[model samples]
Target chain A: MLPELLQGVDTGGLLVIQDSASYSGRHLLQSFINAALNREEAVHVLGFEVSEEELKDGLRGSPVQRLHFHNAYTDPLGWTDHPAFTVHQFCLGELTRLVKQTSHSKPATLVIDSLSWILRHVSTPDVCRTLQQLRKGGAVRSIIGLLHADMHQRGTVGSVCHSATSVITVEPAMRGDEAVAKITKRSKSGKVIQDEEIFRIKDDLTVVVQSKSSKGAKKADSEEQETDPTANLTFNLRLSDTEREAKQKLALPFVFSKEKKTALLHSGPGSGRIHYEPDANDDYDQEDPDDDLDV
Target chain B: MYTELNSILNTTPDSFTQGEFVLLSDRQSDASFLIHHFLSLYLRARCKVCFVGLVQSFNHYSAISQRLGVSLTQAKEKGQLVFLEGQKESLSVLIPQENDTGSQAMDFLRDPSVGLKNLYEFVRSAVSSNGEEGGDGSEEWGPPVLLVDDLSVLLSLGVSAGAVLDFSHYCRAIVCSQLQGNVVMLVRCDGEGEEDEGDDEGSERLMKGLTHQCSLTLHVQGLPTGYCRDIHGQVEVCWRRRQGDGQYTQKKLFQYKVHDKGASFFAPGTSSAVL
Candidate 1:
């Protein structure tokens, strides 16, 4: 359910991943990219924050057939004329053409490694329009933009988030190794769905979702498995009521009763005697009274 | 290099690790002494250094380094240090030097939107190239270190925070990874009392981003107990080391006092002058 909600492929609307400086949303971004690739949808990543090599290294083992990484980081301003992708091409016209030429008119998932870059560079309204166009523009299936929430104004962050169909916010969890993702999605019928889950990114770039119920249930299951070694056996290991009573009544000979205590307490200092008690499991001979006769 | 700084960081004088990024940040106090320490440290270690001076001029830094025992003038004369004087460059060659074309290390000054790619390219070439012209051909020069002073000034100069971060990243990739060198960047941040100023997210994000990526973070801030004559400021150094499969950080706080010759670092509350 978490993956389905994160994939956001059923309704196909604009999806936004909001992250702060402390926690990164790149793992979620890669999850969406992985989902798109598994479903055979072409993925076009317009990376501006991290370099192309870094992004590629993160998505190293994933499918690269439909994965197209646009290089806005290298020569963003055409200063050196590197002939690569620049930051100025964040508009609708250029993206539509790239989609048309790459996936042969198939709708692709457009991922902005970060929308904060474009939002900071371009106008907020213009960026929103481009987002709406790319999502409803038919060539793109769903757009996932990573918004660094702390990097933009509250109004700009709000308007951009308001324009999206699904918003996933990634934050550091209580544990250092885990992150919490709060997902809010708007269905096609305008129904708002909200969810929260714990997740961790594996070394292989795969996201492992850890729901609360599943975590508790796993603890409970492991507890059940760890208990009662005598649970399954051919014979009954438990005792019935009569057997328990008999076992309790059949005591050994070392029992110290009230009379024995009183007798021992009232004894004088010179008193000396052999107090004998027979045990249930003790072996005794009837002719033990000087049968050897040596003494 | 000061032994106090090196010992606090738990680094030996001989062992060299490539691709190390050291981040210097200050909240309520000036942490430029750390930048000076790193400068003289690398210079004394025989590492080829590229100093990008945005806050102070070459003479200002040279004067201070002379006290610390390394001569920047002699280092530059030996082709060991490449200093990009940002203040002088911005004042002299903003528009009139289009035909000069000698070194456009400050090209971001001309075009803000173009970002700091040119600045990165300048640093890359300066450090990546061979130092045979400095003197010897067979001599092995140490790892190249790129030091940027006052990274916040770039944001004030019309360059965006994202671009400054990108310039740092590209420099790390090429200078650190490609050239097997290190990077030391100093950024100024707001104090704890300063918050919610509205629309200061650019610098705030830059500070947070730099803190997130750097291997070592040394945060210098003014003392919460107010001003003191014996102690200048307190520095919190966090050294992260990875062993086996997990990583843990060793965090320590030190009180320091600046002197005419060099700075003194000691454990907090152990200052003899304070007593």
Candidate 2:
């Protein structure tokens, strides 16, 4: 999924990787490196968050001969050496110079391993300015900046996003070990397009784009179905009193006649039936007002 | 004619009253939605807005406003909106030492007090200019609203806590007291990438000071449930308002689903939504 997406990234455009705490962006970076190598393009890595050894090991098996590294990480001894270039951690000038010199000759893909380090030393605007300069300078054909989205303020992230032509956000999925990579922002030929896709990493380090028709998709579909006007329709049977009586009569002949006579007698007070019974409860009700006056 | 957020504000008797300072705090994930939600409401109400953008570029804000169905271009043309670029100014401070354009960059970089003063002056000028030229004559023009996007960025740029606090006080004084306008400021609460211990302390102090001064504080936080179904994240808003009698009223937690367009408050079991 990422390789295909990387293929879509136009030359001389800026791509931002919004890395989360899960390190899901590492895979995307690897995929980008692989894609660039496959295209026979030179890959220049500006390592700040990771060590040079780690970068070499990560891309060891890849068939890329023109791999260059500019190490910016300082060790505990406060001494570092790289074949390409080494500078103090917070010196933006040296870093900018290195980036410019590397992409000066040919169209190379410049990858900054992480931007959080730079952000720590300089403001987001400075970082954005540097990136804008790089793009405007036309030195690097493609600039990929990796940023840990969880670590920075929203404004910082927004500034970085504002500076980028494309933004890919990688987040962890709710379900087991899978991560979701989304093309949250993509600018193609001066037009911005937004797309989100769920993906999972495999054992072979290849990204498998999960279909949207997964469990969550089905749940959303069901929700849509629920909102349909016809979904709430329910069928119920109704019976009137006469119909119920008729049904009862059909079920039992003698029992129905007795019930019918009782129903007719109780239907009205003037049903032409004579009654001479004494009112037993009425006599008690009349005496209760005086009998209970002891209170 | 107001948006859903205005309607929500209408629920409270004194919510969103004139001359009030509103502070919105959220994590990095849900900040944009909250900011956009309120900004859209203000814009739709046809209020004059001076947006000091420190976190996002003007283009980014414009794109977001367009996506959310707010006419940013029209607002700007009518002098109903003005965007003051804080990101560029804040970043110019960090330009390499040798290449520094001495006078201008040095003005902002020499001291945090100067940056805050510059910001105050910029906002005052923007609001006054927009108020004078408010083009629509159908309705009476009220005081122009002032919005500061993300105060934490200033602190991250080595601004002192005292300077940030002073800046907030000045903004509130200008918008709430002097101009009788509304001031909405955004501050990020979570300290994610702040490596320095002193920086964290400064940010906390700034937040506390702002909270003490602001009339209303909306705290937006992402739920731990992660993403479920169509819900990218769950946000719980705790709105705290300061009353006239020097007491604070705590509102119920408003739960919402953070979606692509914006955040929509959840009904008990139904999904009536908002952007």
TM-score of chain B taken alone, every candidate: 0.91, 0.78
Instruction: Highest lDDT: give the candidate number.
Output: 1
**Candidate 2 C-alpha error for residue A182, in Å:** 53
DockQ for all models, in order?
0.13, 0.01
Whole-model lDDT per candidate = 0.77, 0.64
**lDDT (C-alpha) at residue A82 in model 1:** 69
Task: Count clashing pairs, candidate 2.
Answer: 1
Model 1 CAPRI rating: incorrect
Tens-place lDDT digits, model 1, residues B1-275: 66788887755446656667888989878999999999988888888899999998899999999999999999887788989988888776665665565577777777798888778888878887756665454345688999999899999888988788778767766666567788999998763544644566667778876764566889898888999989999999875433224323446799998888778899999998867
Error of 2 at A9 (Å): 73
My TM-score estimates for the predictions, one after another, are: 0.70, 0.42
A119-231 per-residue lDDT for model 2 (tens digits): 74467777787777776665567788788775556798988888788888877666544566677555555666666677765533456777652555877888987775754
The lDDT of model 1 is: 0.77
